[model samples]
Each structure stands twice: as C-alpha cells, then as structure tokens.
Target: SLTKTSGTSSRSTSQLGRHFHHRTPGNFLDPEVRAFLEENTEVISSGNLTPEIRLRLLTPRCRFWKERADLWPFADPFWAIYWPGGQALSRYILDNPNIVRMGSVLDLGSGCGATAIAAVMSGASHVLANDIDPIAGMAMVINCELNNVNPFPIAIKNITDTKLDKWDLIVLGDMFYDEHLADCLHHWLGKCIKMYGTKVLIGDPGRPQFTGHSIHRQLHKVIEYSLPEPTRRENNGLTSSIVWSYQP
Candidate 1:
C-alpha cells in the first residue's frame, strides 16, 4: 500500500473553515493565501496538456508584491503559474494512462499539484503531492478544488527520507532550477530507481544545472509546448520545454 501521512491532507471539508487559522500566536497560516490567488489569477485550461482541467495562474499584470508586505520575501507564488515543463508531463500522463493507472504515484516538488492531479485523473490508485513550501501546499489544495479533483496528500517537508518503496511512479516537474537541487535530485532519484524499480519521469525547461549524464543518456523527449511570453520571462525567456522518461 502507498504510505500516507495521516491527518495532514488539506482535502478535508472540515479544514476549509480553518483556511485562515493560526498556526502560531503571531504567525497565521497565510489565511488570505488562497483568496489572494483566486482574486489575482485567472482560471484557465493548462497549456496543451490536460486542457480539460482548469488551473489558477498569475498573469503579467498581477504583481507578486501586491500581496501582504509581511508575507513578502518568503512568499514565492511560482506555484500559481503553470510552467511548460509541468504542462508537458501532465499531457504525457493523460495520453498514456496505463503508465500511472492503478499504480501509486508521487509528485515530488509538486508545486500547485498539477502533475499530481493529472496522475489521479489518469486513474492512479493513490497519489502524494509533496512540496517543502507550505505556501505551495496551500496552492495545491486550492488548485485541486478549482479543478474539481480530489486533493491528494500534500506533504510539506524535505522528502529525501520518504518511504520510497511505497511509490511505483514518481513525477518531477521543473525542479532543476538550481544546481544544488539538481545534484540532490539526481543522486536521490537514481538511488530510488536502483533500490526499488521506481519509474522516474521529469519535465525540464532546459536548465544549465540539469546535466546529469545518467539521465541524459536515456532521456527521450515526450512532448513540447510553446510557453506564453509572461511564462517565458519567468523561466528566463525559455519558450519551450520537454518532458522525458528517465530510464535509470
């Protein structure tokens, strides 16, 4: 059975009332985080990939700084944007349902849970959408609701020590933005494949740090899409991206 973190799922209807609840005395859990995203972003279909589902995203006019000042610097709303890499992977899964259907799936660094939602929609038996950022987790929960899909478990922590054996398929979306992060994922994902037979898939917008020889040797492009200018600017002007199946 797929390992699950009990009671932490943001899917429960009961938790909807506590969206603005206080996690600490002075540190409220961005009570307005979901509302801010809904207000600022427009709901639209994902780029070529699962265009049937709606995603809440930031447009060029919506400034990230428009949010509360206290939440500034720490609040990275990238999850609110749909990147090319994620769109590619999601599209691939939809086109190839057997790859995830009836299997346990994990969406690592699952910002906004777009890939995770795709996995679930494709008939995955169980799914875990994990992100170290709590804000991102909130975005995932809300996004799931917008898409009218059941929210998967959202793990808000570094998942290096996770029970790898529990997952059959792992989907990583646009996580190779930094060299250190790229190196860590390269080593850890390789170990997951070697130790267990975990199938690893990745979506990248051609990052400089993503030079993993092992992955590149077996990497085959799955799909590609032309990202809008605003989205391109966010990704350093990279207009297109590829989804690849890692044969480690």
Candidate 2:
C-alpha cells in the first residue's frame, strides 16, 4: 500500500493508492499531480553536475512552498528541492562513472531523483529509487523523465526495516536528519555490509544525526565539494558537502 506518514484521511489515501495498487509505487502518476508539478516547479540543474542533470524542482518562489499548508497539506516538500548532499553526490557520479558501471544501484531516499538519474547516466545496469513520501515518489518519475532516464521505478515506502541486501551499491543523500530514522538506518545498513558486503555510499553535509550513529565508525571520505552558490543558499549555510565510502 502507499504509505501515509501524515494525517491524510483514509478516503484520500484510497484515492491515491488506486494509482499504486497496494505495492511499491511505479510510474503511475495522477494527472492532477502531473499537471501541478509541471506547472509549479522549475527546470534546473544541480550543483556542478557536468552534462547538466535537469530536474523539475521547487523553489521558495513557488506558490506551494510559500504557502504550503494552504496549497498542499500533505507532507513537507522534501523532494521538491535537491538536498546539498544529493547534489554533491550526483556530481561525483557524473565525474566518476566507473563506480557504478554495470552495477545495480539503489538510491535510498531518492528525493528529486538526482542521484538515481546520475547512476543511470553513468552506466548502471539498473537503478531503483526509494522514498516514503508518495508525492516525492511521483516527482521522481517526473524527474527521471526530465532527465530521460531509462524506465525508472521507485519503491515508495520506508525500507529500513528490511535486511535489505543484494544491491551492488546503495546510496543515500542527506537522509540523516531524524534520530529514530538514523538509528534504524545504522542497524539496517550495518547488516547489509556485514552479511552481504554490499557497497554503500553516503553524501552528507554534517547533519547532527550523522556522526552520532554507529555508522560513523565505518565511513571514510571519498570526495568533497564546495557547494554551488544556489545549493549553498538552501543548505542551512553549509559551504560544502562530502561523499563517504562505507566499507565495513
């Protein structure tokens, strides 16, 4: 079923779930939402993504962001903007295509699908995106289309509860924002490493929840980038972001 993290009514959820049919969300998009996003969001590229990864992203100047609750009373529009970490990671993927060549990749919490699109563009054999927010899930499909991604699919739920192994690589960007979510990721990600030796990559700008986790001991920096001017402005005054390799 389409996961509902907010107070949206069951009737409303049923209306939404009919598009997904009680499974991980795929390419299905409600026409109203497709039209709304196409109308409200702006087409732009992320920080330093060479060859230009275009995305339909929301800005504060948009109507929905300026008056969110009044305009769209669902979840916060986390997917509307590409987070700083995701931006840096997407650039890294474009610069270092060999890392994901012919591999299966999962872009966990793939808000805006920037990193996922990079994986596709970089030669990944297959790529799947996962995010809990249904709206974010829809936006990712639109983004993949914006980037001309190959037949993209998104699993629209929190998947941290599963052992979740077998991915050739799993990537996360700016996902370490919540305490409980951080702990769950620590346990689940550690098992993925120890049990399957799956490669993991993290892109972050030192969110407080990051260093406090057990996952901290396993990460080492691979590359860091100074944030582009526009990304810096939105990243809570952070000047840079880092991509860390996880080897357990």
Cα deviation of 173 in candidate 1 (Å)? 1.2
The prediction achieving the highest lDDT against the true structure is 2
Question: Which residue segments of model 1 deviate by more than 4 Å?
Answer: 1-31, 46-48, 65-73, 212-214, 226-236
**TM-score of each predicted structure versus truth:** 0.78, 0.86
**Model 2 regions lying over 4 Å from their true place:** 1-27, 46-51, 68-70
TM-score for candidate 2, residues paired by index? 0.86
Evaluate candidate 2 by giving its C-alpha RMSD to the native, one decimal.
Answer: 4.6
Candidate 1 clash figure, as a count: 0
Tens-place lDDT digits, model 2, residues 12-79? 23344344435344544777667867877788764443338888877766776565243353455678
lDDT values, one for every candidate: 0.70, 0.75
